[model samples]
Target: MEGILIFAPFFLIPYIMAHIFNRVNYSNRWMTYIFSGIVNLAYSVLFDFISSYLKEDKSQPVCHFPLFLFPIFFSPFLILLQFMFNKAIIKSVKYKRNDSQNEQ
Candidate 1:
């Protein structure tokens, strides 16, 4: 669990942000979700690479999975996060547009 802690913020923060945007009925929520996933993937890849390079001369391992394998583990949850956020955004937008149309 401690090991997970290091990567937790990278995933958790974006997940939380996506929920916040969904609540606010932000336009382009799908785009935001996609962008966040891309950013998270990039962050995981970059961090693994850098940490692997640093570990070469040390006795510590930054991750249990191989360098390329880290993204595989990170991807599913990130994609799920995107899907949920995108759904919320779609519903919120639809609701707001309907509300406005009714008002008019």
Candidate 2:
């Protein structure tokens, strides 16, 4: 019960952080990818880091720095991966729109 409560929002990180600044249908897509990745990495890791510090019992049976380090170093890659997925979704939608236009 408690476990689910703690972990559920982790699943929605992308949708929450990824959509805020994305330039859907923008021309310069590389910037979109780079900025989106940067924001997601910063948003996720920074939020977790700050929240951990805010907790009453900061020690949760582990060394916090190492845990923080993992996300700090790894989040960029994950964010970029998320960006790619977003781009793919956008591309598919654009394709569908074009198909519908052609049919009309």
Candidate 3:
């Protein structure tokens, strides 16, 4: 339960962003990938900054470049998930349209 709470944002944020993109009808593959990467990078930096600030070690550097790289390294996988999510949303919308059409 506690662990899920910690990790939930990592998954949820991308999914929510994908949904918003879909809602706005922005389906460009490269754009989606780049946007998700930037969002994840910002999130990683902010989280690290807060955690480090709360720690007692004022001597340690707050910005860890390697930690920032994780988002870039895993962006392909994240983009793949976003693609799938977008496809699923599209399919659902199509299904609803078809249902309404058949009723009419």
Candidate 4:
């Protein structure tokens, strides 16, 4: 739908970026968390701005500002998920190497 089209990037990009960063084993998990949160907030604000501009409405939605804070919840969760993801990737790579060495 139209709503999904507008909001998908706000939710999706940070998740994907976090996952990618995790795979690379980034040292600063907190920085990544904050970066993702800010990105999410910016995207959400942009979505609201675009919607309001298209609708030609001067009235600001009450939920918009509150919604910006939603990223706070995701920040910690994203950091944990990234940590897990990095561990998994490291394990998988080690397992693959071990298996290859065993065959040779």
Candidate 5:
């Protein structure tokens, strides 16, 4: 769908933000996932507004901010991403633990 175009840039923005802003000590995965989603939603809206101007739409709507609601529309994918991030972190921690144990 053409609507998918507006969300293209957002797919990665939130995931990257989740990593960069991720708190290693925090046990609340939900908080991290939701916070990152919110941040990316804001970024996606801004990107949509800015990109809409770049688009050659002669009949462009006055407000393209709604285009950035992809996260809301694709919440299942967001949850999947959260699962992946958590799994990866768990794997990394386990790997580190194994390595330390081996070193001793």
Candidate 6:
């Protein structure tokens, strides 16, 4: 339960970032992908740093692998998720606009 709680942001943040990036720069798909990847990488590094800092014991294992490597392992998946999310958001907005225009 605690582990799930700790890792929830790894999945959620990318979706949120995708929505934000799509809103901010809907014209450029590549830019949205690049920016979302950068943001997720930064977030992974920051999360590792904070978790390490908050640990009370230096010797006990908090994670199976090195904390610094967490981003490397997870970044690709996060970026892919962001890409998919951005595409979905763009499609939804396009449909919404079309619907509204047709109604007018």
How far off is residue 44 in model 6, in Å? 2.5
Name every residue pair that clashes in candidate 6.
none
lDDT of 6 by residue, 27-96 (tens): 6656765665566566656767787778889998666355455556777876787777777775443433
Whose TM-score is higher: candidate 5's or candidate 6's?
A: 6
Per-residue CA lDDT of model 1 for 1-104, tens digit only, reads 53684477456756666766665545656566566666666666676767677565667545546645655676677677667655654455434245766677
Q: Per-residue lDDT for 30-95 in model 4, tens only?
A: 455566666777776777666656875558653456445545555566566555544543333333
Better of 1 and 4 by TM-score: 1
Candidate number with the higher lDDT (4 or 6): 6
Q: Which stretches of candidate 5 lie over 4 Å from their true place?
A: 1-18, 21-23, 56-66, 90-104
Which portions of model 4 miss their true places by more than 4 Å? 22-26, 56-63, 66-69, 72-104
Error of 2 at 46 (Å): 3.0
Which ranges of candidate 6 are over 4 A from the true structure? 58-65, 92-104
Against the reference, the lDDT scores of all candidates come to: 0.61, 0.51, 0.65, 0.58, 0.62, 0.65
Candidate 2 residue lDDT tens string, 1-104: 53453344333544543454355544544454465445545555665666677779845753446434544565565566657656554343244345766777
Selected candidate, larger lDDT, 1 vs 6: 6
Ranking by TM-score, best first?
3, 6, 5, 1, 4, 2
Weakest lDDT window of 10 consecutive positions for candidate 6 = 90-99
Could you tell me every candidate's TM-score relative to the true structure?
0.52, 0.42, 0.64, 0.51, 0.57, 0.59
Residue-wise C-alpha lDDT for candidate 5, range 1-104, written one tens digit per residue? 45565555346644664575455544655575777677667767766766767788759566764665566777677767766766665333333245666667
Root-mean-square deviation of candidate 3 = 5.8
Q: Compose the digit string of candidate 3's lDDT tens values, residues 1-104.
A: 53463345557766776677665644353465567778788877776666667889888666667657767777777777777766665333333245766777
Please identify which of the two predictions, 3 or 5, would achieve the higher TM-score against the true structure: 3
